[model samples]
Target: MDEPLVRWDWIARNWDNGSPLAIRTLLENHVVMAFAPVLFGLLLALPIGLACARWRLLYQPATAVMNIVYAMPSLALFSILLSVTGLTQTTVIIPLTLFSLAVLIPAVVDGMTSVPDHVRQSAVAMGFRPLRRLLQVELPIATPVVLAGVRVATVASISLVSVGALIGQGGLGALFTDGWQRQFYTPIIVGIALIVLLAVGADLVLIALQRLLTPWSRARRSA
Candidate 1:
């Protein structure tokens, strides 16, 4: 006999199985694994990006290095990290953070460079120090582009977290492996739905954040 495409009973049984494989547990794990690298990468990218923006000479080399890191396969990187971190979340996070940097650094540099020359001159004329101008003027103006990069990095990270299952830390990715091993369809379907939902939901939140942070951009567009 052929099996049905989904089994609601299986989903009910495992929804809160009280084990690591439980849906709730994996969902929580997925959220943490997906978001942590983006947060860390953003924090790290800000200063590096600022430096790259200030020193145009550094931008090419920095981006080149980041592109190389980004080109590395996630599974291969995970294997290499295994010997050091031992099947841990750190192995997954480190690579994702590097990947996030590749996308974010360029975004940040472009965003910073996008600042209008006249606007910067006005800030200087207003007696704003370099640091003060960067914080109060340039950064706010750069928010839209930087947030766009963040959205991309975040969604990519969320998708990549599933690959960690091979190393036993894939969060919701475990469901994929489990479904494959057992030839069960429920977990696989559930996992994919959850991942897609997470990506879309996160993107919406970031868009809202961008609007809130850069009301002037909207006003300019509306004009």
Candidate 2:
């Protein structure tokens, strides 16, 4: 029998009861695997970035290592982790989290550094301790830039999380691979479309969120 040319009509029909299970499965896997690791990276990267920016020695080696991790191909990173952990969720999460560090760290450092030195001096003059200055003053001013970093990291993680399917983590990428094995294109096309949709949707949401979080940014925007 000739292969069916996968089209929107075929996709629309399958999207009903036929593929709802697959969609849900993929979405659940995508959300858990993507968010957990990416969030971990952001949490780690932000503090480290702040510390390094405050103390330059830490920035050199930390930035260098993060850049190395960022440069690593996802497949290569997965293969290395798979050798150590053997095809499990760790193989996905560990590498994805590490991969997010480059974007996250730079974002954090930039945000913290963007706090004018005069502001830092004023906070010191007011007797705010170092940590207090950072928490109450610097970070508040830098929230938008830091959130933008998170936006970038999360978007990147969402796109790359599909690679987890290679280790049986079962994301939308799993559907894409499954379609490839079965010689069906619908699942592959649909999976890619869903990923694109998720990325664009998440970016918009994050942008709105950043705006909401940093009200001072609005004045700057208008100025």
Candidate 3:
């Protein structure tokens, strides 16, 4: 007899099995693996992006390096990282961080450049120092664009983290490999559902944050 597409019993059994293989554990791992890189990338990208925007000469070379890093195959990068980090989560995080930088650096540069020259001049006229202007004026104006890039990087990272399952470091991605090996559909379906849920939930939260932080942008759009 053929098996049904999903096994409720299997889900119930593993939902909180108190093991690393449990669904809840995998979900937690997935969230950490997916989000940590974006956070780190943003922090790093801010300075790099600022430099690139401030000195347009650096933008081309920086972007070229990032693009090359992004184009490298994830599996190849994982294999290379394994020698240093072993089968640890760091192996996954390092490469994903690089990929996040690839997306985020450009976003940061664009957002910074989007600040109008007049606005910058006005800041100078208002006795704002360079650092103060960046923090209090330019960055606020650039929030919407930067957050847009963050949204893309976040969703992409969530989906890409599953690829790490090939090396036993994948979060929810382990479910995919497990189900495939066992010929069971339950874990695979559950993983997909959870990943989708996570991505959508994250995206909605970011959209809400963007609205909250950049009310003027929203109001301008509505008008």
Candidate 4:
């Protein structure tokens, strides 16, 4: 019987002998699976969120639907979607995308709504049309908040994508399930650590992006 490798030894060995699928390959696959859904969901949520922000009438209904969808278990949701999407990336992506909407939409609504009323008034007084104002002024001001939500949704999506391992669509999650079945702790522990690190790294990237995109907000706070 092979002896269980210590965590440090496992890392060193992987550098030479390599881990399953090559750690780099697994990492890349993980990124693809995790971020794709987030991007898709954010795109879908943006217009709906903006509409909700503009019209108070849409908020309650939007909130109700998002809440209901968010409440569904990720695995169960994937299972239900499997028949139609059928054991493909679509099954995984669709459910994860829907999950992301629960986070992204509220972020959009809150960020847009939180813009100061005076800001909107100034835009109107400046002869900015509604669409122009939303594109130029409002979204820029709301960017920091929306990005914060994106950061959260990205992290959550990465974690949930692991749940797809049972369906053969798991990226790094395959490591966890394989390790568990074989009683090998190295891959299981390594997979867990990598996922967490990915989440933190993604979050920091978004923070930097927010700062870069919202220079006026930073300048104001600095002043």
Residue 201 CA error for candidate 2 (Å)? Answer: 1.5
Error of 2 at 23 (Å): 2.0
Q: What are the lDDT figures for the candidates, one per model?
A: 0.94, 0.82, 0.94, 0.85
Candidate 2 lDDT (Cα, 0 to 1): 0.82
lDDT of 1: 0.94
| Cα shift from native, residue 176, model 3 (Å) | 0.8
Candidate 4 per-residue lDDT, tens place, 1-223, comes to 5775646776666633554455566777788889999999999989989999889799899999989989988788888988888877677888889999999999999999878999899999999998899889999888878888899899999998888888877878887887889888888888888999999999889878877788766643846
What tens digits encode model 2's per-residue C-alpha lDDT throughout 1-223?
5766566775555555445345666777787788887789988987799889889889889989998988988888888777789977778889889988888998889998888889888999999997878788999998888888888888988999898887777478887788899888878888888888888988898888877778678654856
lDDT of 3 by residue, 1-223 (tens): 4888998999999999899999999999999999999999999999999999999999999999999999999999999989999998888998999999999999999998889999999999999998899999999988899999999999999999999999998999999999999988899999999999999999999999998899889544856
Clashing residue pairs, backbone N/CA/C < 3 A, model 3 = none
Model 4 residue runs over 4 Å out of place are 1-20, 218-222
The root-mean-square deviation over C-alpha atoms between each candidate and the true structure, in angstroms, is 1.3, 2.8, 1.2, 2.6
Clashing pairs in 2: none
What 10-residue stretch in candidate 2 is worst by lDDT? 13-22
Error of 4 at 79 (Å): 1.6
The per-residue C-alpha lDDT of model 4 at residue 34 equals 93
- Give model 4's TM-score versus the native structure: 0.90
Evaluated at residue 30, the lDDT of candidate 3 is: 95
Runs with alpha carbons beyond 4 Å of true place in candidate 1? 219-221
